[model samples]
Target: MIIDLTTRKVKRVVKLPKTPFGITFDGESLICCCSGKDIQMISCTDFSCTNIPKTLMSQYSYIAIQGDKIVCTVPDDSKVSCLDNGKLVWEFKNESVLKKPGGITIDDKGNVFVVGMDSKNSLMISPDGKQYKQIQTKEYGLTEPSTIYFDKIRKQLLITNINSFAHLYDVSFY
Candidate 1:
């Protein structure tokens, strides 16, 4: 559903072939992670869709795009994968660090931020998928964080748990 923020009214609704789990926009199209291991690119103007061939067996829970780079979180596999121009570039998996990773967002520098539903924490991973840091933990009141977003303009991180609580933080990269 497309809404008019100024009027708070629904403008239009575009239907899809499958249930959408995660979605991101890359200037022109809406890249969606759908059910049954499907990825689709839907035209923003016409709402027509083109399927992006599946690269992994696991179901994708969330996705984010930056230029030619596409990143997705696979909760069932407890992993996050990056694709460049539809080719697998890197996959990161560390059960101890990120268990059942969910909602994801990327920064301008290509750094990926994801939430671990099982681990009850949020982590920041390097662009190359080599290094990671647990930026938020259960002690920080993160109980089953489900979604995350990075505000590029304001340089803030927003994280939401499974319930009603939402946390916002001032984030900066050096």
Candidate 2:
């Protein structure tokens, strides 16, 4: 459903193919990760849908886009994958660090932030998918964090748990 922010009213509803799990705009089209390994690109103007070839067996639960790079988290498989122009670039999987990875967001520099529902933590992964550092943990009152967003303009990170708690943090990358 599309809403007009100024009037705060429903504008138009565009029907999707399958149940949309994760969605992001790539400056041109709305890239949607649907259930059952279906990734589609819906036109912003006409709302025409085009299917993006799937490369993984696992379903995507969360997604973020930066330029031609698309990142998604597969909670069922406990993995995160990056695709460039619909081609698999890198896949990160470290159950010890991120178990059941759920929500995902990408920074201007392409750094990926993800939350683990099972691990009850959040971490930042390098653009190359090599290194990762824990940014939030259970000690920070994160209980089953499932969603995350990075505000590029404000340089803040927002994380929300499955329950009722939400956290905002000032993030700086040096």
Identify the runs in model 1 with alpha carbons over 4 angstroms from their true place.
Answer: 7-9, 56-60
**Best prediction by TM-score:** 2
* Poorest 10 consecutive residues by lDDT, candidate 1: 51-60
Residue-level lDDT tens digits of model 2 in 1-174: 767899999877878766787788878888877777567788878877878776432564888999888899988989999998779899999999899998899988889999999999998999999889999999999987989999989999999988878999999765
TM-scores, all models, native as reference: 0.92, 0.93
Model 1 agreement with the true structure over 13-70: per-residue lDDT tens digits: 8676667878888999988887675677888788787877754325547999999899
Return the TM-score for candidate 2, rounded to 2 decimals.
0.93
